[model samples]
Target: MTDSNIPVTEDELHAYVDNELPGERLAAVEAWLATHPDDSARVASWRAMSDTLQAKYGAVADEPVPPRLSLDALARPPRRWMMGAIAATLVAFVAGGSVGWIAHGANTKQSMFANFTDDALDAHKLYVVEVRHPVEVAGNERAHLQQWLSKRCGYQVRAPELDANGLKLVGGRLLPGPSGPASFLMYENASGERFTIYASRATTEATQMRYAANDGNGAMFWADRGVGYVVSGPTDRTRLQHVARLVYDQTEKTGL
Candidate 1:
């Protein structure tokens, strides 16, 4: 699709996926997906991932609280004359605090990725389920779609070539991005399994390569220059990486 209609930012997408978006905005995304096939498939993969993650990790919220982690115990002070015991407890607390900090860091990263993944999948899921108007632009209009997206994003955008990898370019759509607007291209195998290559101008500091799985969805994200790219699906890590490499190669070629 031509980029002119792409939203100014991906915040709407984030809100949509997180179920925080309301009324017209949600309706707008749904309407866009209804006509976009490639985007629809990507949304499906995202939904599967979200569902899988929720099923596996949702229980963390319900887990039993350990006595040492109880708020009551933390609020209580050590009794008088317990100097040695208090010292030991303080040491343990420091060690535990360090570990907790590290864990929190990791979790924060996961949560951020999950939010993006959820947005991608939600967009995919909503549009793919439609019988008609699945894309704002059809695959048959590749040249037009490319030109439009490129102009809108203020960068040359090309659909990554996936023919050699047993997937065919189904088409693409312009979507909102963190910095501005972005695009998502969908590819599929004969079995109907699909994957998406999503890209946007990088708005955050450069982040190291990272892999994560949510619900049953897999995502690989990396940033370079001022662009961020994420390739996501329910495919195995090897398959996902293979696609990711192709996307990276193509993105570089197109001057991402």
Candidate 2:
């Protein structure tokens, strides 16, 4: 047991996420976090961020160290340009929008919620390019599409109305997802711009909405009621967010 009088610090929260928290204080911090929604959510976000980074880089950690980086090599005299090159590399890394750069000042990288958004982004990029058969079902049959998807996905699936956002439903299809079957829906505006929404059963019960960008595409991801949703579109943050807001609102009202 820990003294409730001793307040938990930012460092403690991070150590908890890293699984390095001292056993003596662990119970107290957990008890405190249970009553604090903000801190609990922050901890969840950190765990998700850590999971995302591990999924991406864990393999690299297992690779053998390069000969140039070995102890024998370290004993040799360094080149004059080595220091300058190291400095330049760090600068370029920060400027290149790497995940480490995101962790430098803020928790923006916490926006990544494991593999859910990655699958969504990949699906969006894959089907958005189709001029012929983009979807298995056409948008004209919205009711049938909804029923079919709902049955296959084992949940009530509703397609949000996005006409107000100038995006007309281009239809949807079934796809393999992280957990189980996924429903993929596409939308398009008059200018030929495209967007997609992907939903499926999620291991995560709930999460705050977060944004992630890949290649040239962007995604907003959130989970609710045992389902995960990702809205993917152009890298224009404002436009993507606007569409995502509409989808989120509809899902909330309709209870999907």
Candidate 3:
């Protein structure tokens, strides 16, 4: 059905798919769906595509830990003590020559996680505009989404409620993390502006926050407890941080 023919606006359809609509607005959409079966079918098809996406990538978190990640192997000493000393000396020399190298490894890890955040934002930018198929799992199926993602990520997944920030639980997706799988939960404002919070495990340090601007998208990344989180959008820095704080609070409350 065309936009004009449908009772909901394209933006509303987008919100519906994102689970941004609620209360009267959500009820309105339900009422509209009751009268417009074709539109309902279209929405269903779109949701199916989201489901397929989740099926394909969601399990990345659940994959067996790679052999390279074996702690015993990593902790094993070098075969030759002299050779190990020499290697350590060489590393120290390299670290001394380039302070950036010391920071580089940590920076590189952050960059890798940042790239995942970019992917999450890209997915949000792409599918949020879509009238159909905005999410693989609907908001109503949130419990199932949580169970599935938590199981996959090997951590409990809790959907953060953001009503205080004028955002609500839209739904979440499981994405790949640095070591394994990660999670991305999206929220939006009434004006259709959207923001997303992405979290994964960090190898370097405790959660800290950094701001970055990439191709007009502003992102803020932080690590707390064990998970690293990145919040990104086209919105202003202050607004982005506001949203990030909400995410942080919810995540903290969830103990994730």
Candidate 4:
């Protein structure tokens, strides 16, 4: 719609919603929105929600803090038991002649999917707010993205199709893992709610799923053959499990 030939992008739309885009790009976005009713509605809804949140909570900064929340009152010296705990941990690592601290329990019988769960949730929080460059490869380049990440990670990485559900793939990227490379895939629904799938090489032969909750997010992590997969989303346990089943089914069918 504008003189520029460049097509509108999801990042541009997000920036427009958050008012982060430069002034020069405003006209192009508005012009694009004019022709796209769906995007226009989405933008309006986002703005309304943003305005409501700001209006409802914007005054908290000026209010007097509650006694329990006072920083000075809450400050304290570290617990005495913590010192002994640290010393014990150090001894365990050194005596075992292992990779030390970080990998102290690597040989344990526990499922290593727990580690990927934490990483997946961290990645979700980091990239969810990004207005631009959310992924190294966009969904439109699905084939190339799969090939590129697969080669980089030493596995056959396939983008799980969730289009049948309300969610659609946004894109994916390559990320570092505990031992090597990892692949991250992002998806979003019409309501702008998002989910992420992170995959890396397996550290254990665990095929059973591991469920974990952290902060405000939840994940279902598992390992099949040589690959580990984690599906992460908000802390709605039932909903996250539902989405996890879809991911598990798709990846299991093409896990190679």
Candidate 5:
């Protein structure tokens, strides 16, 4: 392992799930995961997905192709009109398959954003532990923080007031998101409980808020006007949803 303090990356998580992480790094990753419940949950999800895929397709790889799809069958001669019909059918099939694959690929790309929750959770965990320098800009400098994040993110970024929900803005920072530059805002309540909001360019234009929770962490994700937003906090679903709704309402009113 490079260093205990070095952050574990998304690729490293994947490698760990695949059992391909280097031996030297294994202990470090495992130790890091021990304290990061969100990451541990993500690892478990990946393992489950891998197991499900193997169970569903493992037999297919060992099976022989159907006779109709064999080279011999394809090479057999046919009447000229039959050959013409086959060619026409094949052309139609290829065209339809191409369109199908394109649509499937697009759907796949959109679905990949579900992983964005992981990124939000990771950022939440990384900074929430900071005692003094939790954010690059302090909450007192809200105007500057918002303006800086907006300019860098190429979007109108707003740090929604959470006072009504018993949370106050702590600060914000810029981050690299799945799509592009992201704006991250942190909020803390009187008890020092912290929450974060991550916003960035989105693949989808608009979406309803959806919740995902791992261990003790919860996040609600949505997209609007070419931007995606994630609200992350502790795993209190009702409380988290209330906070997320406040953020959502503010964005709607401000047209962000």
Candidate 6:
């Protein structure tokens, strides 16, 4: 493994999984992955998934082109939504479960929530211990921070009011999301306990709140008006949900 100054981005991780990383960057990513066990594990999962998919679909790709599936078929390519159905078909075929998923689309809540919660918790762990510079813009600049994040994310963003829950805004920062850019807002209470709320673009309109926890950290995730939100902290589920509910309520009032 070699080391370099340039840090690898999420796109590079995907490229590494697909064997699409440029020659100049491939070794650097490998070196980064060598030292980053968590990222390496994620890369391994994606590689396994890709291998499984290829093993299942390689024969389909090799099959002689059928008359109905000729080059002309590309003229009337399926709509955007159908792409998900197609992916579901491939997953169902490779995974050997839920044959009906091909028709139902690829909106598995469990997997989606896992991704959201994992990202949120990872961010929380990375910044919560910082004594200074935890956020790019301090809570004193709430309006500016919100505006900057909303502009970068291509959506209206706001720092939800959490004072009633005994949490004051600690400020926020930008992050790479599964879809695009995301916003992470940190808040602290009088006890010095801190929590973070992470929001990103989502495919669906609504979702029931879901809870997840590990190593004394807990999070609640949900979706509303095309944004998925996850609130995470080093607290129990009951206390976390209490704060999550407050976040959800305030976010809803913004109407997006």
Record all residue pairs in model 4 with backbone atoms less than 3 Å apart, i.e. clashing. none
Taking every candidate in turn, the Cα RMSD to the unseen true structure, in Å, is: 15.4, 22.9, 11.6, 9.5, 16.6, 16.1
lDDT of 3 by residue, 102-165 (tens): 6555555555456545655554444444334445566678799888878877777777777776
| Model 5, span 72-144: residue lDDT tens | 5334553243444446556657788777555654554345356468668777766665544568899999999
1-256 per-residue lDDT for model 1 (tens digits): 3343555234554455557676656666777677776666666665664565455434443445433223353245532323443454566578887775555545544544554555555444433332223456767787998998888788777887788989877777776654356677777665556677777665444666667676466777877677677887764888788788888887777775
lDDT of 5: 0.75
lDDT of 2 at 79: 35
Whose lDDT is greatest here? 2
Clashes of each: 17, 0, 6, 0, 0, 0
Model 6, range 72-129, lDDT digits (tens) per residue?
4334544344466457768778887775664454455555687788778777766665
The residue ranges of model 2 lying beyond 4 angstroms of the native Cα positions read 1-112
C-alpha-based local distance difference test score of model 6? 0.76
How far does residue 23 in candidate 3 sit from its true spot (Å)?
33
Model 2 agreement with the true structure over 146-215: per-residue lDDT tens digits: 9999998899999999897789998999877654678999998865678999998865467878889987
TM-score for each prediction?
A: 0.53, 0.57, 0.58, 0.66, 0.60, 0.62
In angstroms, the error of model 6 at 212 is 0.3
- In model 1, how large is the Cα lDDT of residue 224? 66
> Which has the higher lDDT value, candidate number 1 or candidate number 3?
3
lDDT of 1: 0.62
Whichever of 3 and 4 has more lDDT, that candidate is 4
Per-residue CA lDDT of candidate 4, range 164-204, in tens? 89888889988766446778899977666778999887655
Candidate 3 has a TM-score of 0.58
lDDT minimum window of 10 residues, candidate 5: 66-75
